[model samples]
Target: MASLNKHSIGGNIFLLLLAAIFMLMGVYFQWLYTNESNAALAEEIAYQKAQEEYHDSNIYYEPEASIRWLLLRQHPAGYFVPNPDLLFEPTQLNDNTLRATRYAISILYELGALDSINPKTIIEYVMENYLADIQSAGEVDGAVYHNGPYAGFGTLSSRPAAVRPTMDALLILNLLGGLDDPRLDLDRVNKFILAHMNDDGGFWDEHYAQSGRNSSLRCTSFALRALSIIQGHQKKGFSTSDRERITSFVVSTHDPASGGYADFPGREATDSYFVFRAFISIWSLASGDLAERREYVENHMEVDHTIDYLFGQHYLKDEGAFSRYYRDLQSVSSLKATNLIIWFMTSMGRMEVLPEKAILQYMMSKQNRPGEFGGDMYTTYSALSTFSRLAVSTEPMSQPKKPTRHASIPAYFPLMLFSLSLLTLITSYFTKKHEMEARNHILARQASIDGLTGILNRNGFEEGLEKQIGQAIRHDKPLALIMMDVDNFKDINDRHGHIVGDKILKEITRLMTENIRVYDIFARWGGEEFMILVTEAGQDKAVQFAEKLRKIIESGFFGIESKVTCSFGVAMYRKSETIDEFVHRADEAMYNAKHSGRNQVSTVPTSAKKDDRVVEFKP
Candidate 1:
């Protein structure tokens, strides 16, 4: 009896232990399954939200018919006159006329109307007539100038070389590739520009000789733009410190109270022209911190009275034209002032806030005929540019196509699986759940990040670049892009297995990430190639940054014993250039760096040179 009782007790204890183990297994599997399912759903929701936001920010627009109407005002001389009313009449040309011509050309270029007009002829004429050799007593010998009596009756009169026209000519020539023409001496032009740098590091206007070294925002802005162009072309114009001085001078002109830039430090009144000039100068030169400058502008713009002054006081409600000043309404609205206002507003990315319909109506009213905006060349040009900028049709923003849904599980599967032992069912469920979670994580990561290096992939890099470009354009700030390629990467992969090559890449990425700023974007553009977008950095700063990156790579080591080096190409975004063009320039520069002997940094030339290769600026 004693033996039988002990046996029964042992059997009971074993059964209870088995049941407890099964229960524990079931609870663990349920927890794993629930956590993974919730995680996947959350990730999908977040990804969908991100996709929607991206699409919303990428809306496109079709330009209106008014831009085409303005093109008809082109002059027979291949330039545009201020008024379409003077189409058949001979017109006098001055700085305003030249500037109007530049604007017209830019508009036509933007509108893809090159088929209708011969820009080459217009460019040739400006280069031939406006290019002057200044040999004055105090000026440097053989200094080239864009000669003009800025306000004049006609082209018949000879005028002294002035800062405004010279700067305008330089900007136009740079934009139209006139600087590359052999007929125009870029060296002399460069010298002429260098001569204008004042003791205060700002530029002087036409009266520099008599003005006693005074600097005005207008002249300084023009000079900086021209210099920036030369720097792009020559890659040797201004030093980092020199650029800093120029930027400092421009920032000094800012009116903290009015949120407008003054002509000079002591001047209290703010004008649109001065403001535009100041903004462009900083944008082109990148002399100061861009984010800070943007903040200053934004703060002032928040309460800007210019909009009220422009629309309320100077606007011609019936005529749809804007006058130059609030006090004067008798004369025709100033075309120069109107154009400046449009450009300023556009630069601030505040175009949508203005009365687009009224502005367009006024622009159309100025047209004398189909494809012609009638007024003086300056006003006509202003109206055309304004129309081109504002004429766009908005459409509903579309979201990106959603990712395909995962396969649904069978409803009866869990019940059927329950027929198996508790431990077996729990093991199967946990295995499937773990697999699903790993697969989802990989899919999500692979979309925007490089699989090997764990950095941003090409798609991610492009998206980031697009966002940065938009911000730069909207705020009138500078942006720099860098492209780097690992030298002899193919050879490295061939000599040492691909696994080793990948290890090197991962190390390189880690090293670069540590060296760059927190905001700077570094991405794996492709196998053995990488890209970086440095916001608010000018060409000079970009070059320096690139050089730093190059050195870091050259000096670093991977787990294997090998010396690795990278070649870098840098480019600053140009105003009005498409994203493709901007990226192409950087890619070209990177190629130049690679071809010119790997492990060096090169920059895109401001103007296309004959060889299509940008000469390395040693400074």
Candidate 2:
């Protein structure tokens, strides 16, 4: 009987071995069928050299369609517009990863790619996969969830109290764009933040870090930015006095001498990013003090010296660092830093209401492969968002154009493709690759523009608008200009504080978006200032539209405690008017309304008298 049992066990083991071999064979065959066969070392070498030979220029995206095509194909889950290689990689999980996922989804939605995925599904996925993990770590005040494995699995004592993740979580909740699903827990997030806010009005990561410890601009900026979003989104919950206190704290944190804001009220590591965040937070709320601080950073804060300082820290590799101040420049991973920088530049653009074109071009030039740039998500987002925001800036760069059969090959690479019958089959593979790439480019461009405001930003506005503007002039179409300014904007900022002021502006942006037709263009031109372009609209029509916009703005669906109003200026195209000239005329008209009693429209012709320049209404 024992012999029989041993023989049976041996037979079973033999069967198991056979099954394992078959499974291995199946996996190999399936991989071979669906994907490219694994390249042998020799083949890989030859292919890489061929790719290099094929790409004459070092610029990855340009001149070589095949390479660009190959890189883009790797983007899984066609969602958030994938950044390029050299940026940062997304981790599978973290302690507060749910919040990061929320922010990522918002970015994708903001970019327009979120349409492909169900918002509910994505939200649920985050809640299940990431949020549950966060909740398991430790709860904060039973309401705010803190002490997570998101950053890392360190005890609370060992970790730096980071306000960025929490703030970001709040902003993500705001960006969910109004489905009051209880899963978001916005009130809980706010309460969490408020509980963390030190007596000094700045927020710290934990209760221990809340007192006497130095606060960082990185943390402070994220906290303020997040709080500003909260203020805009959840207006009723935060009291008027609390809003005032927050605003006052934001103002006080500004470094008077350097104009570069510190991370917290007292610490002084004035960085471009923190300064930018400070300015943007202020700009979003229209806090003149914050705007003034931005100007100080721009005009007074030495860029060259700061660059030198950063360079001195050995942080200026192909990829950049998250922060640098002291001689001992401690570094964070590149992904976080990259986004912070990109966001900083975007904020600066908002403050100046102009494009940082040259800087942006340099950043774009640094984009590497497959939606990554300069070694992390932070820098990649920074560069992309900055580019998106500054699309209309008067910076000179090469315009994007569709490739044609007649298009000349880049002068460097001749005889790169030997047009043979067998090669044609190989070339067909490349052609399909190129087509996929072209589709992605289109999708990515479309996703990045904001839908409501016909202006290019946060998605679709940046790429297309420039092409359209260039095409319009090439085709000689009349372009009408309108500049609209929110009246008593400062009053709103002061009364309700910056958060409600932001909501008011966002609502006004929505209104302007609704009023403009398909042929027209509108952008959040500056803080509480909007610019509109009407194609082929005559002076009479422009004036009429301006009046209508003014009336519409005055009607105020913003629904704050008090009524809001706007003043507008209209300018029709002139025979030889520059973009700047057109904008200036509209600006002058807007100023006229400001000087004239507020909430009125003024249409200025190209040729207006000096006295007419400052048109005054009856008191």
Query: Per-candidate TM vs. native?
Result: 0.43, 0.39
Expressed as tens digits, the lDDT of each residue in 311-421 for candidate 1 is: 655566766566654333353565566677777677666664566666665665566654445544455556666755775433445656655544254334444444345
Best by TM-score: 1
Q: In candidate 2, which residue ranges exceed 4 Å CA deviation?
A: 1-91, 96-103, 129-138, 141-163, 176-179, 207-220, 280-357, 392-619
Clashes of each: 12, 30
TM-score of 1: 0.43
RMSD of candidate 1 to true structure, Å: 20.1
- What is candidate 1's local distance difference test score? 0.67
lDDT of 2 by residue, 434-540 (tens): 97899899887657644444445523433444555676678787666778788878767977888888778778877877888976777766577777777777667
Candidate 2 residue-wise lDDT at 247: 53
What local lDDT score does residue 168 receive in model 1, on the 0 to 100 scale? 65
